[model samples]
Target: MNVKMNGFISLVLGIGLLHTASAATHSLKYFYTAVSGDIDYPEFTAVGLVDNGQFMYFDSSTKTAVPKTEWMKREGADYWDSQTQGLIGEHQTFKVNIQTLKDRFNQSKSTGVHVVQRMYGCEWDDDSGATEGFDQYGYDGEDFIAFDLKTTKWIAPAPQAVITKLKWDSNTANNEHRKNYYTQECIDWLKKYMDYGKSTLMRTVRPSVSLFQKTSSSPVTCHATGFYPSDVMVSWQKDGQDHHEDVEYGETLPNDDGTFQKSIHLTMTPEDRKNNKYQCVVQVKGIKDDFIRVLPDQDATNVVPIIGGVVALLLVVVAVVVCVVIWKKRSKKGFVPTSTSDTDSDNSGRAAPQI
Candidate 1:
């Protein structure tokens, strides 16, 4: 499958779902990133998401896997311990992969930074119980390689990764194993995870949608926040026609309270607004009603930026706090190696912290 995570560095992949919408879907994903320098951050870090909702996290510093939600804590220590071990294996592998990538990219002599990242996951269609799996890798914020199940092939998107792809594709047994892992094992784990956090994961929350301008010169942004499952669509219309010009879509992000938020900007001038009717429409996957805000509404101005900025700021603070806590708790006695950093990313889009 073609993975869609694009804004990984800032950690807003802008998107996935949960609560098994009758026609909606949920996803179970894992993101891992390795950096190649001694930065005051995790050398290796991984996160697990169910329907784009993060449930667990692990990093080289803490050397432990921990649950992020109360419902996730239902799993015993053994489960967390097993996850820790699994991430530990991944950490070592990524450490080596970073170096190998450095060599492959001929960046060994470079003084700057380098990174390798992996994001793999499965999406489950709740209505029909259909599942799709994808696996991809990136280097220095660009696409590198991905696995295709139908052909059981490892495809390299970049020429630099061709040699590695050829080597991986040549290994029939390993390819078969990967195929089974994505199709069967990954789905099995995903189902179990949904069950494990059903109370929280099974609920749906509608978004509070708004339309406002940051400044008179700024675009009119359709903002949606405080929704669950993260899968949402915000669009614009002019004179009852679909409007797409100069529209900017933003990354879907998580709030401090575990809800999700997103904003899309529609650029227009005050003069243009007077001649055409403009409306902001929001459609959440499971919620049946459409939330709409027409232009010239008495209350629809000068609110989005303040709200959006506050949400974005709060998210950054939470992320920083979590990262800092993990770093502080990390064991100082472990072997330190050169590696790159990873940003906690999104579902449809593959993203990581820029190296």
Candidate 2:
């Protein structure tokens, strides 16, 4: 009985270990670098690992996951080990199919994190040696060749989102670190444009005063700007009746880039200005039934108080002038000498003459 029980326990332990290994076989962590010339030597160091089918390679500056396909296609494989050298020696060729590396990464099942790849010591040389003329070196030589990902025969599961295209521009002075940083920035800008395009289209209207004239000789013009195409209507109405005869409406002037703008001029007489019932109606294309009132010009209304003040001032001045004339006439008459005093003096003189 003791022997049988020990055997059963050993069998259980073996099965458990096998299960753990199988689970770990489908995951991997790999490092990739973006180089200018060749896969053997890189110009920039972007070292990270991915495991469990998730991109753990977070860019420190952008705080976002690096695009896997971009790094894979542009930089190629950064993993080089003794086994790879041996395979190249046996085959008498340094070329390895890119699909082979991709398959190896997809099938790895290591549970813990592993540093499967590292890229460093990136340099370039354009000057030729004594025997060669202008030999460009570093990552950009024929020393190493990789299979193009698109032309490869192997196929894997489809990605969640297929990136159709990618484009980038970088300064010549950009090094490995700066290239990675700028790549993240470029990706962010593209995403924002995509989001803007996908959002719903919205319509808006802004009213502006084009011309304001209180005089009847000139017309008061009101314009509505910033209206979208297929959403604009402008007209003039006086006393709730369309006044097309007296109003001159200009054709909608299109912006140089094909945007819509409109202006309406309504000439008013003195009688029309006093009535206070003229309005410029703006109806958006979608909101035809809705009534949107642009602010009416109050210059005509404001003139009433000013005119009343001038009339009152004129009346006060006229009254003051009439009172001053009356006072002057009365003063002249009252200051004149009386003839009675002169007669008494004459009578005294006559009595002296008679004596």
Candidate 3:
């Protein structure tokens, strides 16, 4: 018996409604990358899944939604290995087939994500129940393609003859074969993986910002760091207008700790800085508010208090120094030197007043 499949069935029943319990949508993806030259190689192949529009599963060695039993793992690994060989071999017939699958998946995911967005906005549920689907992609040298299982269509960009042959094959035994593999067995595995990932994936971390100046006159840079969900946008603005020129954008990259970071710079001339204000704005997907950083201006409002404090401090210091000097001078002049001799009068050797 399928242990994982039984657990999925029990979960749906225990939750009362599959529509409410199961993910609103499911997606399976196949990724392939290969290089060719004096040395030919198929570098990597991975299968991934997305549930309810969130990334859920990606493993290079294992097939999606497969049973975790030792026998099944070995079998699934062998099957994927064979599939990879079909993609790598020269003069292969499966290349077009693979490309078709990739195209179908690309189309599905592109459209599927949109559907989920609409579902989120709807007031009431259609109650049509939970749905599952798979998308496939293949990359060979410079070529890329996709296939969507839901639409039973190919998205391979290739010669007409090759595409035509793929269409014919897909309509025949390939159709039944794919339906069995994806809809039935693979989906069971997808459910298993989804359950495992639900508790494990990181979510709901906000980004932090750091600002720095390159030089006395160079542009200011804003670095936004430690954000979850890789899709974040960082932009620069001046006096309420978005400035595109003299702006350098850095690619968003993953941090070692599984978060993401991005940097953007805005160049403001001396004249511009004197007249207007600048702000850095960051927007993250699923975040309600945008993160904004306004450039510090030495305008009257800010500079007045600072200048006033400095002047006051200087005045206090000067006053203290003047008082000390006056006191010391008075003490020195008033000093009546005691005569060493008993009867010696006051200022004889001290140089009498010129008056």
Using all chains and alpha carbons, the TM-scores for the candidates as numbered come to 0.81, 0.26, 0.45
Off by over 4 Å in 1: 1-8, 12-22, 297-355
Off by over 4 Å in 3: 1-30, 38-42, 45-143, 148-151, 158-172, 175-191, 212-221, 241-251, 265-274, 285-289, 297-355
TM-score of 1: 0.81
lDDT of 2 by residue, 140-246 (tens): 11111111112221111122101101100121222222233223332332233223322212233443324444344656665655454323567877777776867
- Worst lDDT 10-window in candidate 1: 324-333
List the lowest-lDDT window of 10 residues for candidate 2: 346-355
Model 3 vs. true fold: TM: 0.45
Best-fitting candidate, scored by TM-score: 1
1-355 per-residue lDDT for model 3 (tens digits): 1112111111100111111222233333322222122222222222222321222121223323232223234334555444433323311323334344435435323221110000000011114534443322222211222334454544444342244436534564454444445555555555554455554332546899766664547567787877755557799887898889899986554444545567787777877877887788998765768899787774534421222343353344333220000011111112221101111211011110000
Q: Order of candidates by TM-score, top first?
A: 1, 3, 2
Worst 10 residues of 3 by lDDT: 114-123
Error of 3 at 80 (Å): 12
Clashing pairs in 2: 24-109, 25-108, 25-109, 27-108, 37-139, 37-140, 38-139, 38-140, 44-176, 231-285
Model 2's alpha-carbon lDDT is: 0.29
